[model samples]
Target: MATKRLMKEYNSIQKALSDTQEYENIVSLEPTGDLFSWCGVIRGPSNSPFQAGTWKIKIEVPQNYPIAPPKMKFVNKLCHPNVNFQTGEICLDILQNQWTPAWTLLTTMSAILLLLQDPEPTSPLNIDISNLLKSGDIKAYNGLIRFYTHKYAIDSV
Candidate 1:
């Protein structure tokens, strides 16, 4: 029997899948184990250094779900402050201790999208990249981000 929490998370995922916007660039989801765990994809935003790139990510819903945000990691190569290059582990506030029960999958996805736009250098998973991002050298930063985008992100169809 499914617990009420799992059912709510399932519903939230369903709603997010249905209402997702095109520009959001999230590809799809597939079950990895039970109803709570899934593998997903999100395309990099356009007009940024990551434009024309697609990155695969994994989403693991916790047993507590909404009360504790889902864990997400990139399955593809990535170079960013909030994302670990080796493990693809992400560092995001909402996904950690600050998570709130009212947050939905859509909101989580939006946060991921925004992270791609502005990575948090203060709390960084990739220290080198974080330092570069903090240096105020826009050209170098764009170049580095673009290089990683080409190495990891895929072209959209």
Candidate 2:
């Protein structure tokens, strides 16, 4: 049942990608060698520090997916308050305690996109980065963000 549901979702995502030109370049979601594992790329939004960057993410669909949220992490390094610098762990509520069966991979990615725009500094995974952001050191924070975005996030993959 889990594989079946994932296949369905995968098909739907592929269809959506094909149908929607806007999302075509911004993101790419594809299954990995294993059906339960998937990979994706999210282009940095314009007018942000991450502009010109492309972020890669990995998604693992649990055996009991839909009943539980998928596990997702950035495959590349990013200097963000909600993202762990070392492990790429994401501190999003929906991906953790607040997850619901109604949330799908698409929704999760949408949430991640939103996170890029508005970070939750109080609940941070990278303390130093969070501090920089909270302390109003916009110059330093954006510098770090741009550096890492150029180094790790901008990839052909």
Highest-TM-score candidate: 2
lDDT of all the models against the reference? 0.76, 0.85
Clashing pairs in 2: none
Summarize candidate 1's per-residue lDDT along 1-157 as a digit string, tens digits.
2357666656666666778564356766556778677777777787788887888777888776666778888888877889889999988888888788877665676688789898889999899888888887878888998998887676622
83 Cα displacement, candidate 1 (Å)? 1.0
Q: What is every candidate's alpha-carbon RMSD to the true fold?
A: 2.7, 1.6
Query: Could you tell me the TM-score of candidate 1?
Result: 0.84
Q: Which pairs clash in model 1?
A: 54-154
TM-score of 2: 0.92
Cα-based RMSD of candidate 1 = 2.7
C-alpha lDDT of candidate 2 relative to the true structure:
0.85
Counted clashes in each candidate structure: 1, 0
- Can you give the TM-score per candidate against the true fold? 0.84, 0.92
